[model samples]
Target: MQLNFFPLNFQFTDYQITDVNYSDELLLDLRRRYNTSHSFFRFGENIYLSNSDSDSGIDIATNTTSKNVYGDNQITASLIKHIFFRTFKKRFISYTPVDFYPFRFFSSKEKDDLLFDLLPNQLKGRIGYKKMIEVQLRLATIAGKQQFGFVINIARNWIFEKNCATLNLEGYNLLNVEVLHSEIYPGSCGILAPNEEFIGIISEIINDETAKVLTNEGEQVFPLTELFIRKTKFNIANYLDFALSPDKTSQILNHIESKKQEIYNTKSLHTEICEIAKALFSSKLDGHSIEFMNKDGFYFTVQDKPLEVTNTFDLKTPTFIFDPAGTKTNNNNPDLGLSNFGPYDSISFDIKSPSVLCICHRENRGYFSKFLADLKDGIPSSRYFIKGFQKKYELTEVNFQINELSAFTLAEYIRVMKEWDQEFRPDLAIIEIPNEFRKLKDADNPYYQLKGKLLSYEIPVQYVLTERIKTYNEYILNSICLQLYAKLGGTPWVLPANRSVDREIIIGIGHSWIRKNQFKGADQSKIVGITTFLSSDGQYLLGDKVKDVAFENYFEELLNSLKSSFNRLESEQGWQEGDTVRLIFHIFKPVKNTEFDVISRFVKDITKYRIKFAFVTISKSHPHLLFDPNQPGVNGKGAYIPNRATNVFLDSETCIVQMLGVKDLKTAKQAMSTPIQIKIRTPQGNYNNPELNDMLYYDLAYIVQQIFSFTYLSWRSFLPAELPATMLYSNLISKLLSKMRNVNGWDADRLNYSLKRKKWFL
Candidate 1:
């Protein structure tokens, strides 16, 4: 297996650095004075300086000391990064730094005219004159070794193509615009600006011609026509509804293969950087120089083979149990399983005759009828819900439709839903809405308003886009019926779990940011926490405890909520004293050490039982990609895509798992799939710490296998999801809570009742 990493070979293990007494003010001044000739970075509590030239004539304080860059992984990594940044900036147009490594890189010359042709008519002349290909790089320790390498990928620089004012006039909300030209404080966006150099977000629109901008100098008025908006994904999406598609992905790959042929060949950039390193550090190293590892080029070949795991349904084969008795099962597929034996837990599902409310525009009545017909009676080569759900689960349908005019407003949607709730309480609702409704603000969006209003009445809603109905197929209905069944409190299948001596509980913590005014880009935004609990078998236990709080109070609230949940479950599940219990937390990307501290303290306090826990973070935003050069492509596309469940251990505590692969890609239009990186946080402190010991003894392989299996448990579709069910469910809850928080009188607590255990968010 080949990674996108290119290894760098150093001629000397130690390099000299000028150590200065670190003060924020002094360090800032030094950086400003020697911005081009030197690199200054902070490590731990101390600051160090590296010069591009041995005798650059730059001076620090008189008491400065010199040291060698040896020992300490963090310090060594920091030195390499600073030196690379100092060298790369002189050759390329670098953008704002993303984390420690400068990920975004652009060429001095235009790569192609692709963006020019793809730009909308209104944005053609408003864009920048130069178009470049953006190259992203990641530096990491590969193959569990201390050796460093750069992971590279290329994309079209759409960000540099257009300006902010062009998007603002094109109907974009200019509340949180990024500024590209600010020198004092770059990439700072919000209301608090300390000086004129710190001018940031547009706080308010004073008039059609003027706006109030918060800068360091104070709240100042600026001409709307003159304000330059930084081109970002948010602004572009809001203005043009742009998203990355297969065609765009293919175009990017093709361009890189042609124009930037050295990237794939791993030749041009590697040699050029080696020469730059030699010039920058040869004199500083006292006679040594740097170069690239020439063994089979710069790419690192992963020595460890990827481990492949398969999902099991009943502690046996990879199959689905279609009935409560476990007598009927199908190993073929989820759809075929349901068609052959019915849904799991069908015997106990009390809903005998389910009533569905169909809402659509009057002009879409024809499409609505056809959709309903396909649901009731299966389309060609598909099993109808009547045969599977109605026959096996005794769930006959009592359906009704309400078609409003095309000009219907949000108020009309509320009125109709309320009337329907009072007259005929529906067990479920299937609303057909136009695609444009997705572009509206959360408070004004009919989709959220209607869904929240119905959910308050204990009715789950499944929304279908009108465009989808026009291109409807049997497979679409299959996925829809699966979600509808699960939403109605029916279990399609459960992951196979071996009965073990220890009890295990998986908790997923997900959050969403709620802006004070979403459209106006208010700096004051609160975070809503969503927590989902699940058994080891991937069964969702209850409704999430959703809470909205200030950023500073989020972690405290999260800890308190976890304690409450554990207390309730101890009594409910009959957890006995001295029983071995394991608590595993699956969270999204966490930015602080507060989460580790919180979970560790919680585990230590539970004296009644022997507790073991794993705090795992699953992230997809990193610049890591896995490639299988020997694998065959799907119809001559995505040849390097690995298979699902293929995992490579980056180190003792980190592993990257591919959730979707070649088999998962149904069409050539799909973009190349990326894997999710899972890292288990090793407990801090000494080996004598019980928490540290427990974490160290836990098998990481078990955690990775369980995560892979849980991805198959998402009832939303038969295909495996990119995220495991724990994270997926929590994210769904967080998104819905954030969207409905703006709806007037929408009580999220209503979910604690009958809908608590159902898949309402599905």
Candidate 2:
């Protein structure tokens, strides 16, 4: 049959050339669905991919064989399978049945769907990838023998709660399950398990006597008797929002709502947030000089990071983060924590300082191929600034690319890294990606997929952006500092030791809200506060719980909550009963003096123990914006901003801290970052010993330093903390409990006793 290729724009009798890449139309088709520009390229065999950045950039890959792919997050496994069919158009290439996503990644829900045979190339040699990839293996001397167990989501699993599979799972079981068939409580209408995480409209009453419930855990099938219905239909505007259906059970919901209504009484909490605009710079605390650091300096800790006050919290050694699934070898014994290192800070970052780079990337935007093409045996472009870094830090350089997933999902990142660790252990892992991908950390892209999966396990990781590595010469030199920190790891380069009289403990409270089945067809929500107590040295000891109570009352509720928190530290940490203690409470937002009136007429009674209470609110969101546009000694590029650890005290008790950098904000691409406002108020707060000079005893600098130091401690990010440990740990725990509220049961006493020492929240 004779065929003619006509122009795309030309009119045809009935047929149309819809897709330019597949159709061999002579002219272009501009008047398609989207009104956007397009780029067409032809490799061998006229290979073409649609290029439209406005259409959310595309990813394309081609192997020497028939394996090929091109799409914007849409190229499924079936789509890639067609490449073989197209390559061997004259004959059939398939010999066995094929089905599966090309990526090694799978959601917790997709466990049943995946075929074991046609998995990602990285998993071929590994005996079991799922357990390793999905779990982080940590060793502990339970009795005496070293037992290997998974850290689960923290270090090993990148995906954590970030499962993108919209596919329905069978049940909400085992996924953040809190109470497992523990109680049978009476419901408003039907006797129920009030805490059934998934409350959905009965889609179908199956003949199997099961009810279909669409929950946040995805669609689930529950036995019909397991389902609970409100006495009346309370319509929900958004179904995906898994709120307690109106009129399920009010044991949790009604009480919280009643408290909030009684607490607020007014329309809002407060109209005016007192801003201490006039403030003096606090330079010292208790006669000790305070220092500020831009970023966490990779110090020679264990030895370099001299311990001022010896504490039991152990610092982990230098570690790597990457998915080892596709790698040909398994790291049977991944070097985790400081087990083998000598007395000094030996096992920390300076892990045999002639440092090595474990390069592991998904689709590297061809940087991997380009770097290799330029230097067959020498350093790739990704390590362009390596020489400068080496000269700067005096270290050796070796590249070890841990093969795994790219264009990876959260679960995939975690699972692959877990599995890969079985074969390979790295001092530092590199997952080079584009800057755009790093920013889209929304629910869609989930930036934590890369950092969270590795960092939580204390695995040192570096995300080398394609923008930074594409042109080795143009890589930001200042960025080398952190890399040096990672390569030559140890304890953080902290400020000089403070006096032993540093008597202070902080309580961080994170607020998370959940739904409770309410009476009279009311689906109301209650805000719960999760708290963690940190000793003076930023050691997280015990976590406390305050159910749905804000900063109201004679502050008795908060003080009462701290009684157990205080007792635990005293008994476990040897803090005595009569010793004077400085209690600092770190909350999320700014509060008025009304919230800080602890010593006011409202409270006639005080604790027997000597206590000085301070209320400091750390604003995660504030209106304050700061800039060091033309600071001398720093970069003069109009874009340059103050380095991390910048502070501006508005008053003795109020300050603004630039915990992170300008690079972390939305304006990160366009402008410098804004600082967080720290508002403080002390009502009859006095921690001074009679001998100390008031002028030299200035506490603001020390308080500010404490806040800044906690930022670096969060394994959540390599960046300095935006929130302190008390708040950071609290925030994490609150989020975990809130997210898995269906399973999160709260017994304040139980949590302090059981979970205080665990990192289960992370």
Candidate 2, 1-762: lDDT as tens digits: 000000011111121111224333422332232213333333334433333323343233322222211121122122222221222221222211111111112222233212123223442222111211111112223222222221111001111111111112423222222111112433212211133332444454444455454444445666644443321212111111233333422332343334433222111111100000000011224422111111111001001110111111222211221222212211221111111211122223344443233343556646754553332232334443333333333334444555555654555565656665455555555565656765562334534444433433445455656666667541344243333343334322222223465356677755554554322222434445566777664545676666555434425655565665666676776666566666667778423343344323212233444555556778755433334423321232214344456665544556666665544433222233445766665443332423221212236656676676666455433344567667777777676555333422323233434334444444
**Angstrom error at residue 51, model 2:** 64
Worst 10 residues of 2 by lDDT: 272-281
Each prediction's TM-score versus the true structure? 0.76, 0.36
How does each model score on lDDT? 0.63, 0.38
Cα error, residue 171 of model 2, in Å, equals 41
Question: Please, what are the lDDT tens digits per residue for candidate 1 over residues 1-762?
Answer: 555455555555554455666789977887777755666788767776666644544664633343332355466566666555544444333343333343443333333343445555655534422332222333343444555555554444444444345546556677756443332244222211211222467888776677787764557777665566555544444444333455654554454445533233222333333333344334445645333121111111211222222221111124566765557776647666776667677677777678887777788888888777767666556544445335534465536555554555776666566555566768888888888987899888888888887887788999999888888777687788888888988887766554674788888888777654422335544676777888886777765665777878877887787888888778889999999888888889563665676677777778999877888988897655666656766775556677777666665677788788888887654546788988887544333675557644355677887787778779998888999888999888887887788877788777765787789998
lDDT, model 1, position 381: 63
Task: Name the runs in model 1 displaced over 4 angstroms.
Answer: 11-38, 49-51, 55-71, 89-100, 113-144, 159-181, 184-218, 221-227, 232-332, 360-370, 380-388, 392-424, 467-471, 517-522, 683-698
For candidate 1, give the lDDT of residue 209. Answer: 71
Could you tell me which 10 consecutive residues in candidate 1 have the lowest summed lDDT? Answer: 294-303
